[model samples]
Target: MSIADPAAVREHLLAAAAAGHPLTYSELLGRLGHAFTRPKMRALCVTLAAIDEAAEAAGEPELAVLVVRQSDGLPGQGWWTGSWERHRFTGEWTGPEARRLIERLQGEAYRYWQERRGG
Candidate 1:
């Protein structure tokens, strides 16, 4: 169940929720087919947060909200920086919200990486 696709990643999250399991970063990445050392995973999560923030500020509120809501339990930064920190939100978000956020951000990130690589 490699979460190489954003939609597949979302589906996996939904499946986890349906199974009455809590979503975690490690779990998400496990579905994604890449195992990140804690530090690497932390870095990647931080990058997602930064992208979310920037996207929100740039009038992409939907994307921003999705990231913020989905990445609730996942690790992130307290403040925007290269440094990674754990972020815990007050309320739990639904599986749909998490899927939406993960899909959108993952798609955007993939496209960005593809362009960079192609160039």
Candidate 2:
């Protein structure tokens, strides 16, 4: 699958979720045969947003939560701010509070996909 294919990306994220691990943005880009570039990262974020919308419609967890920054293991600013309405967070978007929120979301994705796969 290529980076341009949203479906393929979704599947890739689902696999990551099932494995119960989050991936760095650079790691995901590398898996898709691309380097870390701002434009490419923005494009990926677009795809990830679409994936999350579809997943939400299908009653699944947001798969994009599995992709995070290597520094803090939290998603990028776009996710924290843009998707804030969907989440019930009220604290700062850093430190332990933010980490717990991301971890909880990632954990939900992990359990959902893992159980669905009967693994």
Candidate 3:
């Protein structure tokens, strides 16, 4: 069981989210090509929580969407459960789905940071 390339997975996820599409398992494999594996994919999903934590520390509320966990679904699937202003959203997501959502938000945050830095 090899690990998926986190960076590649992250990039793909971010691009998909930016494009406004849900991340699907099949899609992930397609994007990853022969580099895909079940264990690596699962690990990638688990890593999303860390991204959320970082966003919270950075004081970005919208990024909280990545931290929320799904309550009613398979072990590796579900949607955001954390506080998002006044509303909450839920849905299914494979490993790729979670990764993409976090990456997309992070990309936005990165742009915000760059703007703040006057770059």
- Candidate maximizing lDDT: 2
Would you list the C-alpha lDDT of every candidate in the order shown? 0.42, 0.87, 0.45
Q: How accurate is candidate 3 locally (lDDT)?
A: 0.45
Per-residue lDDT of model 3, residues 13-35, tens digit only: 44544454334554455556644
TM for candidate 3 is 0.40
What are the per-residue Cα lDDT tens digits for candidate 1 across 1-119?
43334345544533443343334556566656667466645544554455545545765321221222234642243322322222232332335554454455445544443454441
The candidate maximizing TM-score is 2
lDDT measured at residue 4 in model 1 versus the true structure, 0 to 100: 32
- In model 3, state the lDDT of residue 73: 18
lDDT of residue 13 for candidate 3: 47
Better of 2 and 3 by lDDT: 2
TM per candidate comes to: 0.33, 0.94, 0.40
The segments of candidate 1 whose C-alpha lies over 4 angstroms from its true place after superposition are 1-4, 38-75, 78-119
TM-score, prediction 2: 0.94
